[model samples]
Target: MITLYGSPLSGNTHKVRMALAFLGLPWDERLTDAAARQSDAFAALTPMRQIPLFVDGGLTLRDSQAILAYLAARYRPGDWDGHTPEERSAIALWLSHAANEIANGPAALRLARRFGLAIPEDHAAAVTARFLPVIEAHLERRDWLAGDRLTIADLAASPYLALMEDAGIDPADWPAIHGWTRRIAALPAFPAIPGWPGEGAN
Candidate 1:
C-alpha cells in the first residue's frame, strides 16, 4: 500500500488524496503537523520541507501535483491518464495554472485567513477578486478543466476552490464554479478531506 505524509487540512495534500480515491487506490495516511515537515526524516523526502509526500513501492515522491500525475500514470494508464501528447500538455497547463495562479491567489489568501497569517485584508481581497472571476470564466462551459472526462486536473484544482469560504469568497456569486463543484462532489468514491464538508455543505 502507498503511504501519504501530510495533514488532512492541506489543500495540496487533499489533491493527492482525491486522486487516490478517484483511482480507487488504497493508501495509508500518515498525518503530520507543519513542524514535522521540517524533521530530518521528512526533509530527506522533500528538500523544501513540503507536505504530501508519497511513499510507494520503495519510491518516494514529493509535490502534490507531481505525485498525482505519477500515481495516475503508474496506476490508471491510458485515457484515464492524460498520457497522450496533447492530453499531457493540456493536463500540464492546468496543473501549472493551479500551482501558480490558483495557489498563489485564492488558496494563499484562504490559508492566510484560516491560519491567522499576517496577510493584509487588501491583499486577500485583491487575490479573491482577481481569481474568482478567472475561475468562474473557465468553468462556465467545461465540466472538467483538462479533458472532456475527469482527470488529475480536476483533482488538483478542487480542494483550493472548495476552501474559498475561508477567504470570504462566496461561491454563490459564481454559479459556474458552484455547478462545477457539485459535479466534482458527485464523483464516485470521493473521500471527504478535512476543511471541506461533504457535498452540499455550503
Candidate 2:
C-alpha cells in the first residue's frame, strides 16, 4: 500500500491525493507533526522535512510534482503521461510552472491569508498578474493544459489556481480558468481539496 504524509488542507498534499485517487490506489494518510518532522526518523526520509512525503515500499519521495510524476509513471504509464517527446516536454513545462509561478502566486497568497505567513502581497500579486493571464490565454484555446489529454501538468497546476478567489483574485475574471476548474473537477476520482469541493467527473 502507498503511504502519504502531510496535512489534508495543503495544496501540495492535495496534488498527491488527487493522483492516487485518479489511479484508484488505496493509500494511508499520515498527518505530519511539525515537531515530529524534526525527528531523526523523518529526517532520514527527507532532509528538507517537507510535508507530502510519499512512501511506497522502499521508495521515499519528496516534492509534490515528483510524487505526481512517480505515480503516473508507475501506475498509469503512457496513459496519464504524454505519448511523445514534445508532449512530455509540454507536460513538464507546466509542471515547472506549477512549482514556480503557481506556487509563488496563488499558493503564496494563500499562505499569507490562510496560514498567516509573512509573504508579500505585492510580490504575490505581481506573480499572479504576470502568469495567470498566460494560463488564461493558454486555456482559452485548449481544454487541457498540455497535449490533448489529462497529464501530470493539469494535476500539478490546478490545485492552487483553483483557489483564485481565496487568493484575492477574481475567478470570474478568468472565465477560461473557471471552466477549466470545472472540467478538472469532472475528472474521474478527483478528490475535493478541503475548502474546494468537487462536482465529480461528468
Candidate 3:
C-alpha cells in the first residue's frame, strides 16, 4: 500500500491528500508530530524530515509539488496532468508559484498567524498584498490557473488559497479567486482540510 506521512494541519500535506483523492489512490497515512519528525526512524526515511513524505512500492518522494506531479503522471495519466509540452510547462509555472509565491504568501501568513511562526508580519502582509491581486487577476481571465482543463496547477495552489480566511483575509475581498475555489471544491473528489473554507462551497 502507498504510505503518506503528514500532519492534518499542514497545507503541504493537504495538497498531497487532495491529489490522492482526485486520482482515486488509496494510501495509509502515518500522522507525524514534531517529535516524531526528529526521530531516528523518520530521519532514516527522509533526511529533510519534512511532513507529507510519500512512499509507494520502491519510489519515495518529497515536496508536495513534486509529489502532486508524480501522483498525477503515474495514476491520473491524461486526466489531472497536462498533455502537450506547452501545457505541461504552464502547469509547471503554477507549481513553482505554489512552492514559492503561494507558500511565501497566503500559506506563510496562515503559519505565522495560527502556528506562531517567526515569519515577519510586514513581509507576510507585503506578500499577500502583492500576490493575492495577481491570483485574482489571473482567475479573472481564466477559471483554472493553467491550460484548458484542470491540472496539477489547480491542486498545487488551492490548499493555501482556500485557507485565506485563516490568514485574516476575506474571500469576499477577491470574488474571482473565491469563486474559483468554489469551483475546485465542487470537483467530484476534492478532499477537505481542517480549518480551510471549503464548507458549503458550491
Candidate 4:
C-alpha cells in the first residue's frame, strides 16, 4: 500500500494523486499543515517536513518531482518515463519546468492570491505572463509535452497550468492549454484537482 502526506487542495499533492489514479494504485493520505508536519510522527517520517511526502512500504520520499519520477520508474517503467534517450531528456526538461517555472509562476500566484501568502504578485505575474505564451505556443502544435505519447512529463506540467484560474489568469486566454488539460482530465482514473476548469462537470 502507498501512503501520501499532504493537503487535499495542494496542486503538488494532486499531481501524485493523479499518478496513483493512473497507475491504479491504492493509497491513503494524511492531510497536513505546519502543525501536522512539525509533530513527532511526521518528523520521524521525513525531516524535510514538506509535502507531498510519499511512503511505499519502508521507502519514504519527499518533493513532488522526486516522488513522481519514482512512481513512474518503479511502477510504469519505460511506459511513463519514456523509451529513448531523447524522450527521457525531453520528459526531464518538462519535469524541471513543472517544478520551477510552473511552480513559481501559476502555483505561486495561487498561493499569493487565494491563500494570501505574501508572495510578490508582480514577479509571479511576470513569470506567468512569459510561461503561458511559451506553453501556449508549444502546445499549439502538440497534444503532449514531451513525446508523441503520454508520459509522466505531461502529468507533471498540467496541474498548475490548468489551475491558472486560481492565479487570476483566465483559462480562455490559452485555448490549447484548456484543451490539453481537458484531454488529461478525460483519461481513465485521473483524479480532479480542486478548482480545475469544468471540474466535477464530467
Misplaced by over 4 Å in model 4 are 199-202
Using TM-score as the yardstick, the better of models 1 and 2 is 2
What ordering of candidates by TM-score runs from best to worst? 4, 3, 2, 1
User: Pairs clashing in candidate 4?
Assistant: none
Query: How well is each residue in 1-202 modelled by candidate 3, as lDDT tens digits?
Result: 9999999888899889988887788999998988999999999998899978999989999999999888888877666777878888888888988988888888889888888888877887887799888889999999998877788898889888888888888888998888888888878888777655564752
- Using lDDT as the measure, the top candidate is 4
Misplaced by over 4 Å in model 1 are 119-125, 195-198
lDDT of 2 at 164: 70
Clashes of each: 0, 1, 0, 0
Model 4, residue 41: C-alpha shift (Å): 3.7
Off by over 4 Å in 3: 199-202
Taking the tens digit of each residue's C-alpha lDDT, what string does model 2 give over 68-176?
A: 8888898877766778888888988999999999999999998888778898879988998999889999999999998887888998999887877677777879888
The lDDT of each candidate is 0.79, 0.86, 0.85, 0.87
- For model 4 the local lDDT of residue 166 reads 87
Residue-wise C-alpha lDDT for candidate 1, range 1-202, written one tens digit per residue: 8999988788888888888887788999998887798689878777988888899889999888889778788877755567688988888887887787777777878877888766666765776677678778988978887779888888887788877777667777877877776788788987776555456676
lDDT of 4 by residue, 11-128 (tens): 8888899999988989998889869988998889888888899998889998888898998998988889988999899899999889888988999999998898998789988888
Sort by lDDT, top down from the best: 4, 2, 3, 1
Assess every candidate by TM-score. Answer: 0.90, 0.93, 0.93, 0.94
